[model samples]
Target: MIQGAGTVILWSATIERQADRPLAEVWDNLDAVWRRFNDHEWLSGKAHGHAHRVDGYARHTALTVNEQGWHPHFHTLLVVSRNMPREQAVRLAADIAARWVDAAEHVGVVASTEGQRIGLPAVALPTDSPHQARRQAHREAVARVQYASHQAWGHPGSIAGTPEGVFRAAAAGDADALDLWHEIEEATHSHRLRSVGGIFRTPAAPRR
Candidate 1:
């Protein structure tokens, strides 16, 4: 059974100078920044697992590029377990923002929200759904994939595999799979991944 729902803490920061750099470069930089935030001691304590016991935590980072010339900042979504209180979660998120803002002069922390709210479509639950039936089935599927993928790859598996990794994995022989993956990835990149209570919620409502 799932213990708790997940919450996403979204964050962003702007850069002053618009460097004519590839999107990959900007993504790498943003990943590095969040990695540092995740590795901090005080923040790690709030993480879910044992690996987060010290200065490291298992958190996912999504990087988005605003080509609309919206300051060239990044949108970050940090997944936290649902059991955490809102105030505590917000406080921890704020700590991360402060550190990132201080690390780079041009990068100033932007707004932070509890979950991904815009662009992505909402998932509709069946009106007559039986209690625990839908959630249980979803949890089982998620556990299976998480276990299998983690064993296959050294890293812990995301509830849904990373869109980039999924796309690359499927691009060789399945054009259809590639196209489908691309669409989902693009949506996630634009809207940010939202988390529902269970693990296997649709990509539209990712677990953070």
Candidate 2:
């Protein structure tokens, strides 16, 4: 994420789960998408979960829900041990999107259109500062917070439910909001918000 961190490569790509696969549907059946992704070896990884040794080829992947017009696509950020070729990166993103489409079809939901189009993959992007990557992360966090805050969205439980207003307050130098964010962030936490895999994920870690 810094100017130079040869040990890690940060990149991002957004792919939709197909129009037919609505967030509501995925929300209702979390397994429909998450489970299959977990089982599939779309990426070359010998390990799963985050407990793997840091030296292993670990990737931290987060799922984002875009409450857009008709389709609610997912945004993913991948931090891999090696810098993947742009072509392969695009393919990986495309393949994941296809997998989601297949998951929907498996559930008897057919999309009218093809799977989501793969956006150009950003490779070796800087994330430590005010780069696009950082902005994207903020947007994802904000969206996750918004989606979870409104229970009407039907999210099972919010892992990112810490009031975003508190974040803003904290940024404004409000010590109370900063303290509250830390308290709620720990208390409201549940499951892992992101998926970790690839050789970077050590096999020694407990299986999910």
Candidate 3:
């Protein structure tokens, strides 16, 4: 329920629909699951890249069509602002998968017994870790994001330009960089690529 500060856990999971559902509805289903996790996470007053909520969380998500044209799925990089044990994280992740199934049903979307699946694996990083270490975290984050976005709808230029490009842009204040992001969103018609809560955000806009 609680963890040490200065440490953060990064989780990677896929939120998937059991059947082919409308694109819009798929997003709704994922959003429902996202909210449930946010509401229940044990508060850990740790800072992300920037000062953030005591129990802050951040994520980078991309949508893709499941094997069949039946529905879309999400590859998400979930970041928790706390140092939690692997066992705890595993338990919580499994619970969240069940919650997603229930949440989608409640939302009047795909609620089948096999309706939604969120597979979670986790790794922890100290907030004050070295640049290389943080970049490694970002690498995992970027990989998931690109897999979803590129798989669903190919990007002429790699979404992040390079594997770590996404992390670099997270802090860029450049208008063009922002616009490129907008294009990415437009490609998928998604509201967000990276989601952040509390004082925590993916990256700060580079200084003007």
Clashing pairs in 2: 56-200, 57-199, 57-200, 58-200
What CA RMSD would candidate 2 show? 12.9
Q: What is the lDDT of residue 104 in candidate 2?
A: 56
Give the distance in Å from residue 27's predicted Cα in candidate 3 to where it truly belongs. 2.4
The Cα local distance difference test for each model comes to 0.40, 0.41, 0.47
Candidate 2, residues 1-208, lDDT tens digits: the string is: 2123212322222234433443344333443454555453544443543321122222223333223312223333344433445555555556656766666556554432244433332223334655445434433443433343233234435433235555777778989667655644553354343445543232475679
lDDT of 3 at 53: 29
Which sections of candidate 3 miss by over 4 Å?
1-22, 36-54, 80-82, 111-124, 127-190, 202-208
Order the candidate numbers by TM-score, best to worst: 3, 2, 1
Q: Each candidate's TM vs. the true structure? A: 0.34, 0.37, 0.46
Which candidate, 2 or 3, would have the higher lDDT against the true structure? 3
State the lDDT of candidate 3 residue by residue for 91-147, as single tens digits: 655554665656655655554334333333323334556655654554555455445
RMSD of each: 14.0, 12.9, 11.2
Residue-level lDDT for 2 in candidate 3: 23
| Candidate 2 C-alpha error for residue 110, in Å | 5.6
Q: What is the lDDT of residue 151 in candidate 1?
A: 46
> Model 3's lDDT to the true fold?
0.47
